[model samples]
Target: MAFSDLDFLEENFIHYAKENTQSNYANKDQVPTTPGQVKMMQELAKQVQDYGVKSRYNEKTAFAIGCLPANTAGVSPIGFFAHVDTVEYDDRFPIRPQVHRNYQGEKIILDEANGVFLDPAEFPDLRNLQGQTLISSDGKTVLGTDDKAGVVSLLAALKYLHEHPEIAHGDLYVAFGPDEEIGLGGQRFDPADFPGVEFAYTLDNGRPGDFEYETFNATAADLTIKGTVVHPGEAYGLMVNATTIMTEFLAALPADQVPEKSRGHDGFIMVTDAQSSVDRAHVGLIIRDFDWDKFLAKEDLVKNLVDRLGQKYGPDRFDLRLRRQYENIYNGVKDRPYVVNLALDSYKKAGLTPRVQTFRGGTDGNFITKKGIPTPNLFNGGGNYHGRYEYVTVEQMDKLTEVLVTIAAEHARQSQTGRDERPLKKYW
Candidate 1:
């Protein structure tokens, strides 16, 4: 079953997505969900209610809402999460998002007048968005698909569930948070506010068909390689090229494991920061993999590389430090096999192959799982996140809503007495 009707969401969503002068701060798209976005979400909450799922503004900009089957047969309660804050980007101006006729499997030229283009070559993913009226920014601006797509999909799912109350489901918790891009989304989240099942699905992934049970074991590694400054002419053997030595340090780690070179289940070493001059140089790194043991091994290898390099160059020449930033989510959630396996089935029941994934970066799900809410990240039908070339398929958004509906129905069935089966309420 589908939403009773799409016009309500279509009309209000379009109106909500394109508001003006809302940019409160600098060029940062800072029109925070404060009073404005929260207002829109509150308006959305009025459309449906089961538990104030899209409830109201709390500490940081956040809103909650719940959708449930109107009948008694519906079982299980689960939360579906997505963020509302758009990332700080360039020129998100006067966006004239236009919809085409019935998506005839063709390319759309958003606005060719501004010397910008969205063609098939640069983004082959467009082929999958065919026959769907895709929403995007005009050529000169960056489309806010990093998460607006997710917001819309969740809203659409709620809209659909409300319209077709006959669909089988239990309590469905829905949330849209703020400041996620700023690393603070999880800071103010009250799992109690979205209380029900112990698990949730964050509809905020890179592409359709993406279901991630795990993410890289992430940590920030900083190493500073010091060198003495001497006159160029006197810089013979004594002059350790900090830049050259840095290159050797890079080479010390495995070459093929870089993010650009690695893929499915492949671990990698990423040097996110590198800067140098004749006098001094500093380098930073992040190690990643889906497996906890392998991830730890990688971090050890990096520490060993830096230690050996420090030994070769002496303590004066090399200073190193490592700390655990955010860790992988699999081990924490793996015990609750239903957390990942059920989601895969939800994806399939929605007619998409869930590509159980490993993130190249960390997400709120990584932290949420640790917070005792085995939340896994799911797709929002967008690609090229945090950039100008980003795009999300309306079809993908539709499918994602279906996935949300499926999970809610299944989760409630697995629970007892309308509460989470796992030991979260007390522990959390």
Candidate 2:
């Protein structure tokens, strides 16, 4: 079934975007970290039931799960995920999505009085979206297009399949998860929620043609330094400055290996924050690498540097702690090449040239893949994400819906005929 329902996609996108589902990192201990996300997830659970799927909202993980039963026999189930929470934004202003119908490729003033404009010069991708129904923010706040577009696209796909039951498909599972922007949602996802599902896709971010199976392997590091304090007049050879020690530790980090200096396929160690006093100092950092060996080497570098400093000063003067965050998605899917080949084939069937690229950052797919379900990221159809300039088009979202439907039907066909077991190409 060709799903061309622009109105359904646009209406749901706009309705959800205005709901202020921004996640709170300060309240990370909370299930969803915000009440707004829970409200939306609950509503989505009920909404999916209208399309003949058995749906429910899981309170523990804050994920709304739905299952569409298969019409075909002996086909394995597949799943798709979309996050409901957006990134942290200014709460003083409310999100108000502005819709432009049949865009003609001109600069749009998101707020004329505030002098905020979405110009084509600043965002060249806007030119490619001409003649499509474009949606943007009011320049006062974000439009929440990052994953909301993904949510609406999934809804359109589900609605399409429900309306046309003749299109044969295997069991389809959908999950509307929370806190993806803050990196907590996928970590809590229970693979048991998706019974019998072998693989899945995360409709997170990218253009319509973008497909990513590789992401950064990440870890967080915390360093604490202790120093002796004394009065300056009587502190000769008796006082050790913690700030000075913190500066030395910072200087030891490789300058060339940082986010500012790194790009495609390169790994980096970044100091996210640092604070120090005469008595104590603390440093927080994160490490990201596509290669597991390089990632471990980076971690070793931190421990080695701290050990050297401890020997120089004292063993009790410095303490370092490292925590693994998420592993690269490629590590899980490399052996299962069919998971990738099927999506690329479905993209081609939907008339989009496959543009496979490495995602330099992490996604919900990272954690989900670690839980034994190989999930990769697909496009959510938006530009300038996580800010006021964010925008998406009805046509781009429609393309995503088509891709979702194609994947379900194609997976069933391949199971009956033969699976695409093509060797996955190295895309670094």
Candidate with maximal TM-score: 2
lDDT of 1 by residue, 327-347 (tens): 677757766776776776667
Clashes of each: 13, 0
Candidate 2: tens digits of C-alpha lDDT, residues 4-117: 699999999999999989999899999999999999999999999999899999999899999999999979999999999999889899898999998988999999998899
* lDDT for each candidate structure: 0.66, 0.94
Query: What TM-score against the true fold does each predicted structure earn?
Result: 0.80, 0.98
For model 2, the stretches where C-alpha displacement exceeds 4 angstroms are none
